[model samples]
Target: MAQDPPVSDLTDDQAALELQRLALVLSQANQAYHRDDSPSIDDASYDQLKRRNAQIEQRFPHLKRSDSPSDQVGAKPKEGFGKIRHRQPMLSLANAFEVQEVEDFVARLKKFLNLAPQSHMRMTAEPKIDGLSLSIRYEKGQLIHAVTRGDGETGEEVTANALTIADIPKTLSGAPDVLEVRGEVYMTHADFAALNATQEQAGQKPFSNPRNAAAGSLRQLDAQVTKARPLLFFAYAWGDLSEPLAPSQSEAVARLQALGFSTNPLFITCDTPEELVSHYGAVELARSDLGYDIDGMVYKVDDLALQARLGFRATTPRWAIAHKFPAELAWTELLGIDIQVGRTGALSPVARLNPVTVGGVVVSNATLHNEDYIAGRDSKGDSIRGGKDIRVGDWVQIYRAGDVIPKIADVDLSRRPVDSAPFDFAEKLKQEGIEGKRAPGDAVWRYCGDEPLADLAIEALKHFVSRQAFDIEGLGAKQIEQFYHRGWIRTPVDIFTLKSRFGPGQLQQLCNLDGWGEKSAQKLFDGIDAKRSIELHRLIFALGIRHVGEGAAKLLANRFVTWEALSEAMQSAAPGSAAAAALVEIEGVGEVMAQSVVEPFQDPERFAALQLLLAQLQVSPAPQIDSSTSPVAGKTVVFTGTLTQMTRAEAKARAETLGAKVSGSVSAKTDILVAGAGAGSKAKKATQLGIETLDEEGWIALIEGL
Candidate 1:
């Protein structure tokens, strides 16, 4: 069997390739585990893959895939349950393992909010109970529906099942007009044991854990079955509230309790990092005795206003983090290493280990980091394992933490393979009939082989046809993959010329294919033709340059206006050149992004490809969206607080449509700051910075002429 090279041996190109493969595998596994209720892989292995994906993204943010699994919240809802779209997505929190990590979390939050390092930021630390996340919606003081946190965006409606749980109040006394109480639905250890015992007596399969018992019971198709199960709900947070609950996290929990919902008593407020850590230890010590399982403790910014300002990332919230207990470790035999090629032509090493149980899950593989790590060195090339290299057939320490990839901690020198030799990454690539060379000033090797280049081209083609880019209606990912494998669509330019090259009278009609009929084939060709006269922004985004998302593309399009202008601008924009600095001036387009845009255009092969693509279509000039007539045009505006006239999203969208640059922070450069009700620190900061501030009516009046 072919072995993966050690992570230490991986080139940047190889890591990117492996990340793409892992993204697909882990997404499928998540689907099976969360939606189908059938786990194809053990939790440890799944966590390992997710961890690897995250590591690669962090190292190569520019190459972060569009369909990145890291940005995904949860699996899609199963078919049996009715779907309910949440007004606000139930986001997951970032994790911290050590006290230092917890401290770092607080420090990072302080920096984001522009607070001094020593400034006390009040926070709440609560036991993160191991349970299913449930959201119960109440309207007009009566419970309307309840749902599972399926994929965060939309969830499976379990209103019937929820009504059976006595702990979930059916009617609230003084609740908001519209309230979506979100929290954990868990089974106590005593309840779980009794249920399992009853199941054993009844000849049914018993649940493996209390969490599984609670989830399985609550998700029962029959409401009566759910009623029979003892499940408890703890309301800790609110989702869609028509009116404000409280000003702080602690007060909100108290409000939920007063409104007739069970709240976790362990939830406590901490004014400092030391208090947070102390409360976390207290929760951990009392975990086993609490009658319920808790994997960690969660810390949230107490001030609701701060939480609003912090907002969210692509997936997790910025205002909160879960400080999990350290991962469990177990010794496993190092089977062998495998080399996985990535789309970007980097060769990555993966460690295959004999199956071992860690943290109640089976781990079959762990990350070896890189060549240095395999050679018993850390990322900085410092000796970590007494200079003893990790070899095949050696006993290795494996670790698995929540949502963290399993990693090899140390090697047992006593059990090292006698005949083992240092793995040569370059030699291995040659042995596999792949040609690649390490670049100057870079540790990772880049593949020079034709097959790897083809893989890169195939990825580009997929992005070119993606919804956010070219958006070829009839040609989806599956169809593109099939076409590429069969040598039909070799390049993105080939896509535009498909119908012309392979007309109806061709020797092999698309209709002759097993999956394609005459009508479908015609539709595919028509879809390809419809995209010939694409907008400048779409073409720029379709290029799939690193760090260049749709927003960045739009910014570039607005600045450059035409294909020629953009091409000239990129060609002239050398790193640290005034031309590059000009590109960065465009709101939201940073230096890293500007460099990615220019570097690809500078490559001869990529330049040739772009020329070919440009020749095959009509690229239009970027439209100026009524900029000349709008007062907000070319202005940097910040919207803060709550707007009763319109939502934060609606206001932002409107501002952008009127050619205004909507910024998240209040800086000295801000032309206008729109302050709504509850306007807090950002409003104060705007005043301190001497930036123009406007209320909702003032903003509306300014834009009324447009």
Candidate 2:
């Protein structure tokens, strides 16, 4: 048995003796496993040691330490993206890795909050998206900007690209004017697959995994690049708001939803950790069917007031915890190896496997990662149990780092016989993406070769016309998918032809089918026509490019002035490669967005067809700016309280058209302060400073003429 670390409490002699008894053994074993990529025992045996350490500490509870190796986080934070200064510091959660850990987490919360064991404390469990953290800012129902978690103090601005996420609401229903919402920006399995396929086709390197994809999407310098990537979000936190929020965590989320923020749907209120874990299991099973990737479950205490009282640690909050799922691990046959290039232009190896289910989803391949991962071994220099020079028929174990790509874990040596020959990856590519549809040079990692691709195409079309994409009210995703599958529609134009495509005879046949009707079909066509007069920005956005988002499209439209100008700029093959070079030369157009923009235009047939479709619609030049000579022009203003003179809507509308940035809070940066009856926080904040404050009459006088 390895020696155990001593408790932190007094009785130095005993403590030192205990640490000495276990120091070298425990540290060596841990180093071998975590750092050196070697394991002294199987997972079960390793768990036994940890359990023993836990038992010893339990007997000496006072000696328990926070910095114990048992409680450390995996991998340090990566260096990139600027930091963000959160109004409240974003913190890491204490974990509930296993069922027992979950029970303990609940027990600790109950004890800390002075509750009965069976007390009905409402808790919420949300999927912990295994991706980058982002904060989105909105003013008057319109998206203004977005940022990364950068240092948790200041993040790089990437709003132009954030507009591309299909699921994120571009125009939140009843959106608050001053809203700062935080969410995890992630990539879906389908998006990742398509993106990697394109990358492979162009001989560009793919992402290491989906988490990296999400990170890359949010960290782009140009919003357009961010827009082109198929990123997704689920609001989990909030910053400054126009109004105070509900008392409970669940209610706050509900309030967010009421204000048009997209919150994750899997959130639940639980009284105990067991129930929390039950929810976790339910969600884990559903991951295979969900739109984005998630690795753990987040549990938050319900009461906001209680949460404030509990407050936060420097890095994480005391009111919440993250319970990680059982990591994905499976043993399968290592049939061969293949090499793949990455976005960063690095080469990697992928393990091809006999299809096997890991964590309930069928995985037929695993990432070999860098050359080091394939060639390196653990302490004692033993071969990595899984596939260090794996033979053609060797059985290997694969583990997903989070819930994304599969990686080699270890091998079952006892099952291996001496007759197997070493596997070669380069040769596997000649056979891959054929029946299985694995692409060439995809040796470092492979996706499901036999995944029903037809269904994916349908899914893609559904994504294209989704609410965020085109906001075509009448057509639903399932309907689009069905239409595509039935060969009724092929392009965006096909969506317009749905009603015309289905003849009355076919319509009558469809009416006999479920969820189909003459009225519904007619409504769909009307909806399609209603969107015919698409705006310049929205039309550019609906094309479903990888990262060309609404904000970027808007910027591009504004800069280029017209569809012909923009299209002409994109199509020019002038010296310095006018179109491509110009795109890449644009301040925000980095390699990724430049490539994405260039590729779509590169297809002459598709470009010609798109241009023809665009020619049909009456695209707006820009939103009509209301004529205003209002008093608040060029000033930053925040509105508070009920307005008696003018309606709140009237005041905001008048203020917006006058070219003012209407903010939410009474920050030091605020210039003009408009106070009304029943004003509270804003009034107090205004009073703290000698900034000129206006009552209802004064405010009325300022905007009376305009």
**Top lDDT prediction, candidate number:** 1
Superposed Cα deviation of residue 89, candidate 2 (Å): 2.7
lDDT tens per residue, model 1, 472-527: 86786667777888777888888888777875555255666655676777787787
Once model 1 is optimally superposed onto the true structure by TM-score, how far is the C-alpha of residue 187 displaced, in angstroms?
0.9
Q: Supply every candidate's count of residue pairs whose N, Cα or C atoms clash at under 3 angstroms.
A: 21, 38
In terms of lDDT, the poorest run of 10 residues in model 1 is: 1-10
The lDDT of each candidate is 0.80, 0.64
Error of 1 at 345 (Å): 48
**Model 2 per-residue lDDT tens digits across residues 98-163:** 788777777777888898988877788899876777778777878877766654555556666677
Q: What is the alpha-carbon lDDT for the whole of candidate 1?
A: 0.80
